[model samples]
Target chain A: NAGVTQTPKFRVLKTGQSMTLLCAQDMNHEYMYWYRQDPGMGLRLIHYSVGEGTTAKGEVPDGYNVSRLKKQNFLLGLESAAPSQTSVYFCASRLDRRVYNEQFFGPGTRLTVL
Target chain B: EDQVTQSPEALRLQEGESSSLNCSYTVSGLRGLFWYRQDPGKGPEFLFTLYSAGEEKEKERLKATLTKKESFLHITAPKPEDSATYLCAGRYNNNDMRFGAGTRLTVKP
Candidate 1:
């Protein structure tokens, strides 16, 4: 089912440049999340959507923005990229909170800000 | 604040050696704890989920056990194919999930 897929497996950006990462899922999940994984820091949530048209800040939401206009897609945008923003970003989706909590993760996008 | 911590950032084992990885969490209203295996440059693969204390799940040569405060992933007779970073996460407040830094395991033949 290609549970979840992310666009642009790898990218390099200059400081101040902006870009958006796209996440798509075909599982009809009701929850979507964006997280950054830094070495030794684990995965830190940047933003999440409980459902279409709803977005919320997470543990590390600064320097990132997100949108979930459709049920199957979630997007994470960087207004001004910085060296500190360079990391591996992952997208995940869950079927439902009450019914199941296991998250299905995408391959991940590796970003490098120069 | 919710936190999930794993011990022994890295480990090396010989073939047939058995070991256990640890995951401790501090989160209010814990809903579930999860285990995942991730190979380099790839996404995490779900392993097991523990919903409550005293729960245990097994897959192949790996076993996951959960308690009120922590979880353990025990691997038996490790092989090179089992080499990867193992991660654990705790879900709470329904939507909040916190992941550990992960424990990298290397099994050498």
Candidate 2:
């Protein structure tokens, strides 16, 4: 069902350059999240959407912005990329915010900023 | 601060060897514990979820057990296909989920 998919599997950006990452899910999930995984850091949430039009900041939301204008898509934007922003980003979705619901993750997008 | 830590950052075992990976967490209140398997260059895949102490779940050759402050993922008769990073997570009262650094397991044949 293409549970979740992210665009541009890999990307390289120069400092100050801006770009947006697209995330899509066909599972009709009620919750979606954006997280960055750095070596030895596991995954840290950048932002999340509880529903189609609601977005909220998470543990590590600085330097990133997000929009969930549609029910099936979530977008993460970097206004001015920096070397510290380089990492593997993942998008995940869950049927609901219930504790028992397991999150489904997309392949991930690797970004490198110089 | 909520935190999740996994022990034995990496492990290598023979194809038929059995072992357990540990996940220790500290949170205000526990809601759920999760286990995920991830391959190189890929996102994590869900494996099991345990809700409370004494709860246990099994899938194929893997079993996950939960306690008050920690969780354990037990692998039995592992195969090469089981080589990957195993992640553990904990959901707290505020719905914030914290993940561990993950245990990289390599099962050699």
Candidate 3:
């Protein structure tokens, strides 16, 4: 299984330009999440979905939007890319919300907003 | 606020050296603590999960132990292949998972 796969391994964006990072998981997970990792910082959740058609805000949801129209896909969109948004983005999925359930992560997408 | 802090920002050890990485966390309601290993230019890979205090889990040369307020990942006889940033995360009752800055370990032969 692919587990989780993210599109556009790397990208360079000009400020104010918009782009969407796509994430797909073949694990049939019930929970999917989008997180950003900045240098010297831990991963911060931007948005997540418990299931298809259900999206919720996360710790750093501002300036970002997400859609989970299908169970296997979660897309993160940056309406207007900013320098602050230049970071490594990761997508993860898990089978359930149980405390013991482990998350599987994708390779990650590196975004550089100049 | 929920937060996680990892110690010794970075560490370099000899091939046979043994060491432990610490992860301290605070959350309104603890659900679980997780450990992951991330290689350069790749995403984090799951290692273990501790659901409650006193719980322990192990994989190959790594062992994870959890306590009331912290978790420790013990690396035994680590090899160069084990070199990477180790991350710890805590899941709360609200379903939010907070991660630590991570401990970078470099095992040199």
Q: Which stretches of candidate 1 lie over 4 Å from their true place?
A: none
Write candidate 3's Cα lDDT for B1-109 as tens digits.
8889999899999998999999999945878898999999999998998877889888899999998888999999999999999999988854568999999999999
C-alpha lDDT score of every prediction, in listed order = 0.94, 0.93, 0.92
Report residue B65 deviation for candidate 1 (angstroms). Answer: 0.3
TM-score of 3: 0.97
Candidate whose DockQ is highest: 3
Question: What is the Cα-based lDDT of residue B68 in candidate 1?
Answer: 85
lDDT of 3 at A76: 98
- Deviation in angstroms for A66 in model 3? 0.9
lDDT of 1 at A50: 95
Question: Ranking under DockQ, best-scoring first?
Answer: 3, 2, 1
lDDT (tens digit, per residue) of candidate 1 on B1-109? 7889999899999999999999999856778898999999998999999988899999998999998899999999999999999999988877868899999999999
Q: Pairs clashing in candidate 2?
A: none
Model 3: pairs clashing at backbone N, Cα or C within 3 Å: none
Can you give the TM-score per candidate against the true fold? 0.97, 0.98, 0.97
* Superposed model 2: Cα runs more than 4 Å off: none
DockQ of model 1, rounded to 2 decimals: 0.75
